[model samples]
Target: MKFIHIDKENSIAFYQQIMSSIEKAIKEKKLLRNDKLPSVNKICIEHKISRDTVLLAYEKLKKKGVVKSIRAKGYYVRTEDFNFDERYFLLFDELNIFKEDLLNSFLKGLAGKVQVDTFFHHFDPAMFSKLISDNMGNYSKYIILAANVEGVESSIARLPKNDVYIIDQMRNSLKIYSGIYQNFVENIYTAMESVLDLLQKYNRYILIFPGHKEPYDMVTGFEKFCREHGKNYSVIPDLKNFKLRKGQVFLIPNDRQLVETIEKCNHHHLVIGEDIGIISYNETPLKKVVQNGITTLSTDFSEMGKKLAQMVLKNERKLIENKCTLNLRKSL
Candidate 1:
């Protein structure tokens, strides 16, 4: 490994400075294809920087196809020439099973003609702004999942309007942007209507909504459903210290809460689908087997990803609403 210099006083980010140094080496023929680079720990120790900084730099290099990593070994130069026809910046709130489906489908739809670098904000406003600002002008397109984050319109405004696409949840501030999103309010309200007959068996409807990580429209829809139907309902932050009783149907959005609710039911010796009911938000393969199949009202994530790909490929600017469906299983 060659000596790499990092300037701590410079305005450039530490990871970016490291990336620039490596790219400069490769361009100037100092680093060749198949050449092994210094280990992350070694770089961190030599430069007196955190391991995360070095790892971030290496990860970015790997994403750009300038390097590759071998299991139990280290990073190596993958190619001398670095060029991509269509580079994309994909930003998401977080990764889950349904989101993974969407991501895989989006990749499949691209057909190997595009390079996509994905990042997660995890619903942090500052991190969301930083990620967008850091990657501006570097990618051909930006696909963002603005999941209930406030004041992100300014960050998104920095990108080229024609090259940006929003996904998952769309806010009024982001209405000018073209993307695919779910109408959570309408979807939830309609889904409840579809299963109104089954819901009548329960005495009250309880929704476990930890608001920080969930869509507010879901709460609105739940409230609207109860109000219009004249059904007794209550919204709680979580299932913590809450007692589960018979004749109460629970609408759970987060999977962790769904599991907790099921366990609470079991602890009380209450049978699912009979004594207490459950309806989860997103559908996954595991959901089909958990508790003899948990019922779900979910949007078609795979379809959303495919539509997004189409919009990007054709340069179409349209606000498309992906469809949602209710899957009635034994849990309901």
Candidate 2:
């Protein structure tokens, strides 16, 4: 790890400064690939800062593929690959159940020598632009899990035609080329209708747990449906605050949280949302957790992955404009 001074006075954050410096160092060959970074404790002592600072810097580098963390070891500078081949780039906002399902599905049936790069972030436009510039050309096709960006679509519009396809979350405005996008509105409505049906059987107040602040298709859809149906629903961030109403339905985001929450809900008879009714948006291990079988809105990740690979390999850009489908399950 290279020794350095992280600026704290600049409008840019201290962690961001650390990241910028590290990135520059990597670009200038100051930090060689596979070079182990300074340990969190060491960096904190050297910089006379907190562990959070080091963690933030490490996180940024990890996200950019500039650095990686070894289990039980510290962060290390990532070496760039010399050989280039046709690949499908998978960019995501975060790692969670939704992302897991997408990756599992997309990785399905992928055979051959091809590189897959998966980046996760809820990045600003500038950060995303940098990421695109840094990584886009390396892969033949860009499979983006759109996060919240101020003007992501417009920025993507400037990229080479047929290079980018989106899934689940859309980072920018909707106006770019053919790519996979989730029908958030419709999917949520479907999930909610299923919830309502189950609620009719066993009355309960529905409390919606949103993981983050970014706009979510399922959450929006749930909210809209609740409004239209006059069903009681509240969008709460934390489950501890949820007020359970007798016979009221709660539309929690994923099975884990739902399970955790329901367990705490005085053993309320909760329904797991899988693909069919009250389905969870991003499918993964939670599918098995819902003993009653999770009703989920599963993504065709494998199909999308294969299609994206074909687009890149065959130079079929028009297919980038495709929208994704929801795989329904039976929670509701």
Count clashing residue pairs in model 1.
0
Candidate 1 has its poorest 10 consecutive residues by lDDT at 78-87
lDDT of 2 at 66: 63
**Cα lDDT over the full model 2:** 0.60
TM-score against truth, every candidate: 0.76, 0.59
Error of 2 at 215 (Å): 3.9
For model 2, residues 1-332, the per-residue Cα lDDT tens digits are 46566766678777877877776776777778898777889878877889997797776555445676777987787755423234556777777655565577566535545557777656556767767766643445677765655566655665566666666554335535556555666766765566454545434345455555345655677778878887656666666656554444455555566566546543654333321124444566656455555545555655665565555556555533334344444555
Worst 10 residues of 2 by lDDT: 270-279
TM-score of model number 1: 0.76
Q: What TM-score does candidate 2 get on C-alpha atoms? A: 0.59
Per-residue lDDT tens digits for candidate 1, residues 46-105, read 889999999988877765777878878998887898865557899999998888989999
